[model samples]
Target: MRAYETRRGARLSAALMLALAVGACGGSTEKAEGEKPHAAAADYERGPHRGRMLRDGDFALEITLYEEGPAPLFRLYAYQNDKPLDPKGVQVNIALTRLGPKVDRFTFAPEADYLTSPAIVHEPHSFDVAVSAARAGRTHKWTYASYEGRTTITAEAARAGGVTTERAGSAMLGETLPLNGRIEITPEGKSDVVARYPGRVVSMGVELGERVRRGQVLARVESSESLQTYSVTAPISGVIVEKNVTVGGITGGQPMLVIADPTQLHAEFFLYPRDAERVRVGQPVEVTSLAGDHRLASRIEAILPTADLTNQTLVAHVPLSGPTETWRPGLGVKGTVSVGANAAPLAVRTKAIQPFRDFEVVYAKVGNTYEVRMLEIGRRTPEWTEVLGGLEPGTEYVVDGAFLIRADIEKSGASHDH
Candidate 1:
């Protein structure tokens, strides 16, 4: 019985030794051979179910991949919860790479030419991507710039979301149609210079054909409400074309005297709905009064969207260049608006750019430097001149006090760097 018991103990000890030897071999294989039997299972648990988090500068990018139908679809999302991200200066690039033989060629949806492959059909595929761009400076500190002669707004809004009413001048993509325009005199704008509180005309400073400046007193009116005879100044300076009331006439709401600023005497031209589409609020126009001698230069102002029911025409206002004495209401005037082809080049404000002999020059504000660029020239009018070449659209160019900055740039030899 003692001998049988000792044999049983020896067999149990041998079994225990065999188990310890197997455990030691497994640990050695894991460390030196780097063979993880559970590696595929661990990757499957953590890879697709858990997304990859990526950070670039101030931007945070999150990419999630999940098996959808036949392919593993990836959904990419970007967030900047901690800080604001400027869209202007940021650029992103993405690439997909194949690791093992199982990985087929991968492709991006929506058909991007930059995509490397058609599609990843097998397992063990990886996507490598990066986000890189210049960080934009504070938008509020950006100065005023002009494109095609109009003002442009850049930078983020001073308010939370941003200024919705603000607009920036579009850069010139290519040759575009010149904006249609017409001109109007000052009195053409809406006004109510009626004799609302009229009295006796005590004095008359303006004559029938005299050109008056704005706010010039046309005549004086004396009423019980006005106390002593008070002067009624002209709301807009033009010419006193109509004198309805004499020195002693009692007046009420009727017009006491007709005062119209020739420059303000804008003619609201009724354009056919189709024709109006070619015209814009800032286009240049040539005005020829019925009298023929009164040739005036003007620009298209407001374009009323609603058409006249009776005339079926769109009404547009043209602001005249200067005060004129000849333009009067009911007097017909002929306006010639030049409608160019869609491929024609357009002019921008001359204030934003200056002429440098044969070439045009503008100061481009890049970083803290103002670089002067020589540009090609095109058609010219009084208000604006065309840009044939040199500057890109959407890029900020100094408009206000541009010449002063150009002088500074020239003095500092900023152009030497370029």
Candidate 2:
């Protein structure tokens, strides 16, 4: 429903709650003529089956509402002097007064165990109800209102409960392109320490995992043919990620050390062919842990023209611009690429969202009164949601602690209209 309609209905429901309380306590309209209003208070009781009981001496009428079908059903069972009263010739009329001055009338016909309404009742079950019944040459009429699942709290109380409100403002919501990626060592960041020729090992200069500088000797080998010792130097400044030579082992063409700089790593992501065209150099991307807890900022550096033969997905390489320790080769990550963005003139914090009845709603603070407004959401994210309708841009809403209000409304028995 629209905001105006729901707000109006909610306000009417509140009024109905007050009216029901007062009228239910005053008993039925069958009071003796000229009887004082306070002569005998209504002694209505809630029956074991959760039905409403209307009693007068030995005559009782139990009313139960069924909502498991397409419409609201009002079921009534009558008794005379504590015995089943045949309702074959009885007549009943029920009028439901709703907001906007709209009223609906329902007639009743005797069914197997009770009298059922002739037509299905419409919603916003919150309303002022008047029932008139005629049976055995006697007429009876009564009126009461219903306001279930509604609550009201002062602004001061809301504030004390840690609730805060803010008006939504315009923002740019990104069209995220999510991809799975892994940190990798770029060709520029890796180097192999070679023996340069066949030789017998003489000395070891560096150990596995040792940090080394360019041109630093990682091992010294004696050439078997020349019987001369030569040093194997690191081709790049990096940690010795691999080592194959020992102090006394002979080596030939084999790498003595494999050096790689973790800080100079790049991330590779695979995207579908369609997603590849939208990715451009320098497009910002957020890198998150596989668990989506930590984040690092990066940008696309290159887009490979080739597609993976197995997955038929294009590859994109990104350069990390944040702390290097947070990313390492062989680690998987989630990358959100900003492929598109839109301007949202009206929006709200996602934290304020809650499920109310059959709709998603946010509690809007209207002056001293808080109204529950249903929302039509457009673009949404973990932090913000764009408002398509149901709320104005300048309207202040409960951005935090909204669950407290939801609990209060349910406590009022106002949400069980169904």
Instruction: Output the number of the TM-score-best candidate.
Output: 2
With a 3 Å backbone cut-off (N, CA, C), the pairs that clash in candidate 2 are: 148-413, 148-414, 149-413, 149-414, 149-415
Error of 2 at 63 (Å): 14
Supply the TM-score for candidate 1: 0.31
The true-structure Cα RMSD of candidate 2 reads 9.2
Worst 10 contiguous positions by lDDT, candidate 1: 1-10
Q: How many residue pairs clash in each candidate?
A: 27, 5
Question: lDDT of all predictions, in order shown?
Answer: 0.44, 0.68
Model 2, residue 369: distance off in Å is 3.4
lDDT of candidate 1 over 1-418, digit per residue (tens): 0000000101112322311111000010011111223242112112122443344334443345445566545443433553433433333333332111111323233222111223432221211222222234411111111111111112221111111111113333232232233334444442435554657667677666677776777777777584676667777655677777776677787777676554445666667766777877887667777656887667777778544487577777765544445666566667766555333243455666765434576655443333344666575544455676655554455565554443332332111100
Q: After superposition, how far is residue 76 of candidate 2 from its true place, in Å?
A: 16
Look at candidate 2 and tell me the lDDT of residue 155. Answer: 55
State residue 38's C-alpha deviation in candidate 1, in Å. Answer: 99
